[model samples]
Target: MRPNREDWAAALAAADKGRVAALADRIRDRAQVDLLAPPREGLMLMQLRESVAGAAFHLGEIPMARVHLRLTAPEGVAEGGAALMSDDLALVTRLAILDAALVADLPEAPEIEALLAEGMAARAETQARRALSLDRTKVDFQLLSEEDE
Candidate 1:
């Protein structure tokens, strides 16, 4: 089945630093890209809400990095951007390039699709491992039965 936009986005977001960089490098080698906004690091407020419709609250600020890139593709000019929670400037730059390549539908799109699949699989494995750890700690109330005289 073909992956949707959300799946592709989640894959890129979940990818590790090394994988993102490598993919970005591959895209750069094949296309002409311009840095619309050079990598910039800043602090952004982490907002939280009890629910989707609940009131929001600030959970303090965290370091964030972002980059914007534009590339010339066969179709036209494609703009791509990426923002990350960490302060890794290089990683954000690479992600931006990858995003642009995806938007441009370059020849390397299939490679990117493969990368996304790999990233999503890795994320699923991590989540399964975490779930297993949590399951181990589950408290079974049936085991706590008590008899009183």
Candidate 2:
């Protein structure tokens, strides 16, 4: 089925955004203060909105036919088991993450650097997850959501 542009945009936005109000609540519970810290925590309001806008742009909702540029295969190469490991597809996926991370934090260099680091780790994890899925060998996947797991 063809992807709906609005649902794609909303999914990308929800995946990309944190519940800032909930984060503020957690901070208040942990360390409440009369004058809270400057806007160093979440992305600035405009930046957060721009992220959603950027996602829409990425999905080709801007000035072009909407097409899903996926990472699972490469052009000029036939689709097969090992197509995902091709250098071109890998590079494109990596650059996409880097591009997204570059704009993840706006008007803050340290946050950008931090986002880059997170981006690298996330990219690595995605590759690993993709490989695991491609393996198609079933396992009793225990859901351990922790760095130490």
TM-score of each: 0.73, 0.24
Q: lDDT tens digits, residues 38-107, model 2?
A: 2112211121224654542222221111111212211121111111112233332222322222233212
Clash counts for the predictions, in order: 0, 0
Clashing residue pairs in candidate 1 are none
The C-alpha local distance difference test score for the whole of candidate 1 amounts to 0.76
lDDT tens digits by residue: candidate 1, 103-149: 77877777777778777888798899999999999986766764321
- Which segments of candidate 1 are over 4 A away from where they belong? 6-10, 13-19, 51-53, 74-76, 135-149
Query: Each candidate: what lDDT?
Result: 0.76, 0.30
Model 2 spans > 4 angstroms off: 1-16, 19-107, 137-149
